[model samples]
Target: MEQAELPSPPSPARLPWDFHPALTEERLRLCGRMLANARRDALAMARYEMGDDPWSVGCRAFAFGRNRLQRAASSGDYPWLEVLDDSAHFVFVIGGNGNGVPVRFYRGAADEPTERTLRRQEMEVQQLSLALGETEAEGLAFRLAVET
Candidate 1:
């Protein structure tokens, strides 16, 4: 008797959403919107800085957890969602000093975040806070021991 040949595994889908290119386009639009908003704020700040006017430099931070459910809809890296959901939380800490005191701000996600993702987000927050020169300390923080 001749041995039968087994079928090969199916190829992974290229798009994360059912809508194919539409999802990619949507995400790109979101990125563009964010950039445009940033640019507008930057221009306003530049105008304020030109006249030697005192500007409020403060950090605003926000963090949210992403679960497998959310990950299933994301078009980005799969490993990020997997690791973040499985084993590590992402914490963003932003520190800056303006008038005299050192200010610290923070944001955190309950779900696990990959080291690379966490680092990238952390750096972004840090740079933003530093640029502002004032930090608003708020949000989640990791505690080794809970004090009653």
Candidate 2:
């Protein structure tokens, strides 16, 4: 008799951490629409991270858990999406509002952001995203995280 092999586990998301908000079809579609409208396609990256507290349950609780990390058992299940820009200067975050994660833009400073500063900022943002539970997104955007 031949022995059968067991199935291997799934692969987690290629992101820094596992976030619950899911990056689902609906959310992705809405986010794509928002970006297209805002003319913010000059983006570099997007990240979906786990969050602690969620302001509104809404449609957010239902993320399709695309990646393996996302599919794993999570302590909390709130999704936060964040997007970074081409220059690596501005960070546009979108985590809430119905099924659509609205975009909010932020500029680091007048001077160019250093790698250390960017890493620090990214860590800070990740922490916040974990607590808040509804957002972060990316690209030429997530180079800070991807490259370094």
Highest TM-score: give the candidate number. 2
Task: For candidate 1, give the lDDT.
Answer: 0.29
Candidate 1, superposed: residue stretches over 4 Å from native: 1-23, 48-148
lDDT per residue for candidate 1 within 11-77, as digits (tens), equals: 9754322322222435433433433443344445544444533222111111112222233325444
TM-score of each: 0.21, 0.27
Q: Estimate the Cα RMSD of every predicted model relative to the unseen true structure.
A: 19.1, 17.4
Show where candidate 2 strays beyond 4 Å: 9-18, 22-27, 38-88, 96-120, 123-129, 132-148
What TM-score does candidate 1 reach?
0.21
Steric overlap count per candidate: 3, 27
Candidate 2 per-residue lDDT over residues 33-123, each given as its tens digit = 4433332222212223533233222112212111211322121343445432223233333353333222222223414655544453554
Task: State the TM-score for model 2.
Answer: 0.27
